[model samples]
Target: MRRTRRDPIVTTVLTLLVGALLAGGWWALRSDPAAPAPAPAQAPPAAQREVTAQHSRQADRPVPRTFDRSAHSTTDPSSTWVIVNKSHPITPSQFRPELSIVRGYQVADPAAGPLTRLLDASDRQGLGFKIASAFRSYGYQDSVHKQLVAAQGEAAADRISARPGHSEHQTGLAVDIVTPADGRCDFEPCFAGTPGGRWLAGNAWRFGFVIRYTPENEERTGYSAEPWHLRYVGPALARELRETGAGSLEEYFGVPGGDYPPVP
Candidate 1:
């Protein structure tokens, strides 16, 4: 009987020792920092391809185009981007643009095709608009300025006529649009509300033109509102001005334009 009891006790002690050895082995595996982690299951090829396509679609979305504001010279007389005002005069003081006749009116050669199309487009809409004046020579502007000064004093002339060298008409890219059906408000503020004027204001940019002066920009342009005056700056620049709400070239280009510097 003692032998049987001793055998049972030895067997139980062996079993406890084996259990401790197994526990130690498990602890060693868990505590080892250099042990390799089990690799995760890979996704199926189809699912991987679907994820890649989704990412490609997102990457393919087009970004909005940014406008480059410095693509042209704002001071070059022949550049479409020229910004002429009271304070900024054409270089050489007598520079004239190459002229081409469009609808019996003279305009810069580059402006002819666009002006012709603009007029034709207006006509298709039944708008009675016509180009009244364009490409006035420096001498002609001088004569006009003197006549204005003679009739209305220097102050009034200054308000209506751009000083001889400073006139945009001399650039050959500026035009005065008028309606023959009603001559009374041809150059008056009331023209802004006319059918043709309203059409030009809304769509001129598409054809490379801008209403150079408005009541909102009179102070900046150093002139009274001239809804009738349209300056050709090419479609790209004109579209930019229209979209940016830039009131005048002076403001858009960040150039000086309030008035002529006091003469010595």
Candidate 2:
């Protein structure tokens, strides 16, 4: 035993090689299966929430299909939606609607009941509203326009009276309302401040009527404010006008209405 001793260097080298081998084997065992590739990430629920919010906004908005503007003819004299203005006149210069009497006032057959109801409602409030003028013929309008032009010049007459075919009264849907009890402001601008006028302004739409010419829309209508002049457009259209806040049929329909265009 004393004669067979190993070299210290050899022993040291052998220990180092064995340690290295052990380290390599441990590292291989620990890293071997590649740690089961990480589970794929999932998306947050935000997309579904955004879609629900978008649907709610769409539900709250108003749909344009609720009312159809083309429901009635705007050019036909008999149509409730007919637009008579300086630019668009009644098709035939002498066109007249079939007339009937509403409380002794002549109006279109379709307008009689609504007009009567309007006046009766006024009477209930101790206000007497009379139909001063309704359903004027082409000749009558011509005469009225002529008189106004002669008395006050063409510029002034254009504000108060419409030309023959351009008159809404020719359609039988227009009425000049007045208070018979006092006749103080009949057909005058002062009437707009009267009780009857105020009531009509606020409530005429209930009976399918609208003040055809208004101070707010005089320029577009080619006339001055006429609080007493009402045009029956049927309840549906009247409601639409009120809801949309349209000043005149011309503005509502995107049509020209400042003044009569030159005759071709």
Model 2: residues >4 Å from true position, as ranges?
1-65, 262-264
lDDT of all predictions, in order shown?
0.84, 0.85
Number of clashing pairs per prediction, in order: 0, 0
> lDDT score, residue 171, model 1?
87
**Cα RMSD to native, each candidate?**
19.1, 21.8
Q: After superposition, how far is residue 6 of candidate 2 from its true place, in Å?
A: 99
**In model 1, which runs have C-alpha deviations exceeding 4 angstroms?**
1-64
TM-score of 1: 0.75
Shift of residue 225 alpha carbon in model 2, Å: 0.4
Distance from true position, residue 21, model 1, in Å? 83
**Model 2, range 1-264, lDDT digits (tens) per residue?**
478778999999999999999999778777888645556586434334334433554586665425556656799999888899998889988887899998777898889999888888888998888788899999999999999999999878976678899999999999998887999899889999999889999999999999988999988988889999999988777877898899889889887888878769
Shift in Å, residue 188, candidate 2: 2.0
lDDT value for candidate 2?
Answer: 0.85
